[model samples]
Target: MKDFLTLRLYARVARLGSISAAARECGLSQSQASRIVADLEDGLGARLLSRTTRAVVPTEAGAEFLARAEAILDAIEDARNVVREGEDLQGLVRISMPSTMGYLEVIPRLTGFTELHPALRLQILLEDQRQDLVRDAVDVAIRLGTLSDASATAQKITTIPRVILASRRYLDKAGEPITPADLTHHRIIGGPSGVAAWAFEREGEKVAVDLQPHISVNDNEGAVVAAIAGMGICSTPCRRPRPEMLDGSLVPLLTDWARPPVEVHAYFPLGRQTRIAARSLVAYLKAGFGEPV
Candidate 1:
């Protein structure tokens, strides 16, 4: 069990690139954690970590061992869960997701999951960019849109309705666009897709417009913020901005037209090697979204 604890600390160190951070997380002094890791190296007869002025990183041998160590720890947890079928789940689940989705969907719906699995620890990493899940030690990621990577193991969760939106202040000044083509005359505040190739369909007719962005932002939340401030008309997942839209801070534009829904998927970076706690979290999310278990 002591050796297992040491392995857990090492895994955290590699993931965070800091021995001190791992020590803090595991409730140990920096020197004690350092000594444990050194003893682990002595036992294995290999230098697993390389310490630098800024960060402690895994060596080539350490990277190989880290993967095995994670798998071993997961297996031990799985064994324990099998024996304690009715008990709360254990171990840590590191989840990756976009800022908007995390705030609007996952975070709000997580209380029940946490309560049910009180022993389980959840760490959510939020970003708008595609993250290197394996390198970052992410168990699961909630990815939006059609996944470009075929190598990843992905499960379709749900789709979010896409819509054109703008603040009432801007629409009152620029006038509401009655048609999809009318958007060409308006300033388009870009969302994640920086370029404006807005796609819309209505009654068997589809219009694809390629308009340059008036102003751009990398994140969906940032674009929504810009639109709320009357920067320009923006595109986003309808459910995410529902609060602002309901409060009359923003208005849905061109409601007559239909845009393709954004795909929401559970992306497992580690594929079949993903932890049970991670899968359980994904299941909880699916149920919250009204999907069949």
Candidate 2:
């Protein structure tokens, strides 16, 4: 039991890249966590982590050990769940999501899920950056677009529709764009680089627009706010600005040139099937997206 706990501590330190942070997560002091890791290394006769003042990185052996450790943890959780088949679910469910989507879409609807499972504790991490399922120790992740990583299993929750939009006042001042090429002359509000490209397809042809944004933001929520304030045109997922569109704060533009819809997926680490709390949350998300749970 001591060795198992030490192994788990080592895995957390390796995943977070910070011993102090891992110690906090494990409810241990920094010195105690260090001692535990040192004991683990001594028992195995191998140095697992290369520790510096600022960061902790896994050695080759540590990386190999981490893979097996994850499997062992999952198996243990599976066995525990099997033993408690009839009981109410009770555990920490750590979920990761894009900040904008999580705030605007999932956070608003979280109450329904929590009300259903009173014993379940939820830890939601809102980050736009890509997170590793194994390293981050995330039970579930709400992801937009395609799932490229082969190490995670993804279930499509919903298809988020794409739309080009502008504030009515902005369109009245700048003139509504009739074609994708006209966007080159318009002031655009967009994300840094990856989310700025606006592509459209109809029939057999495709039109791609490289937007030169007048207002640049790293988050979709910021870009949407800017567009609603009549700053500039924005091409984004419809889910971000649905309220604005409904209230006429923003108007859909260039409907003839349709942007491809993006898929919203619930991601889990590969290997074992998703467990109780995480699975229930995924079901809630699917239902919240207007699909049957």
Candidate 3:
């Protein structure tokens, strides 16, 4: 019989795109994980992954095999669960979500979840970047904003208003703009798409204003810090507003003219048999966020 442990190691490594990361998750040495993957590749007479200094991407063949491998693994686990504990299931469920949200929201509620499912183990990957649920062996992903991809299933969890904000010190020194058009006159802290063109509604009419920022950043969190430090105005999802919003450090600028709310989603691959632990967690998240359908 094929070694199930070796197959699982291969799956984890492929999902993570790094031997070291898989090793850390599995509690094995990096070299050991590497050897196991190499052995699997040799036994199959196929090269499953293309490796580089920066990333490990699966070959077309590897991607196809990965799907089958996951099914096989799940079936095996199902059999084991049926034989051992009847309907009760127990195993590791790996999940990923945005770093800030996971830290602020999900991590705190995990204690109650663990208490309910004493036999299950949970592994969480906290990052700002989107993770491939199938490729990364991630069962679910919590994200904010619209999901353009039609292949996956996205469940809207909550809608949060988008707010434009700046530090009190910045507003005091630069003088707050009374209108959206005045934003072009001051420095704007921005990320990714940069200071988004202001879009608002007034008197039941749509209005749009272009914003010109002096500085640009690639990450929103960094921009939030810069905004809090009194650098410039920033646009961020209201759910992830800077901590200083509550304190005197940062304050909302265009509250009346705020952009439309953005939706938070819990995304996962459709049609797969979700593990019990993952289902429980998803239910908890849906309840906690109370997102409109």
In order, the Cα lDDT scores of the candidates are 0.85, 0.82, 0.74
Candidate 2: tens digits of C-alpha lDDT, residues 69-97? 86787666556656665555565688999
Ranked by TM-score from best down, the candidates are: 1, 2, 3
Candidate 1 residue-wise lDDT at 78? 81
Total colliding residue pairs, candidate 3: 1
Instruction: Report the number of the highest-lDDT candidate.
Output: 1
Model 3 global lDDT (CA atoms, 0 to 1): 0.74
Report each candidate's C-alpha RMSD, comma-separated, in the order given. 2.5, 3.4, 4.1
Better of 1 and 2 by lDDT: 1
lDDT of 1 by residue, 158-196 (tens): 888898889999998999889888888999988886646
Q: How far is candidate 2 from the true structure (C-alpha RMSD, Å)?
A: 3.4
Ranked by TM-score, the better of candidates 1 and 3 is 1
- Can you list the residue pairs that collide in candidate 2? none
By summed lDDT, the worst window of 10 consecutive residues in model 3 runs over 80-89
Candidate 2 lands at a TM-score of: 0.81
Off by over 4 Å in 2: 1-4, 42-45, 85-87, 179-181, 192-215, 240-243, 255-258, 271-276, 291-293
TM-score versus the correct structure, for each prediction: 0.91, 0.81, 0.80
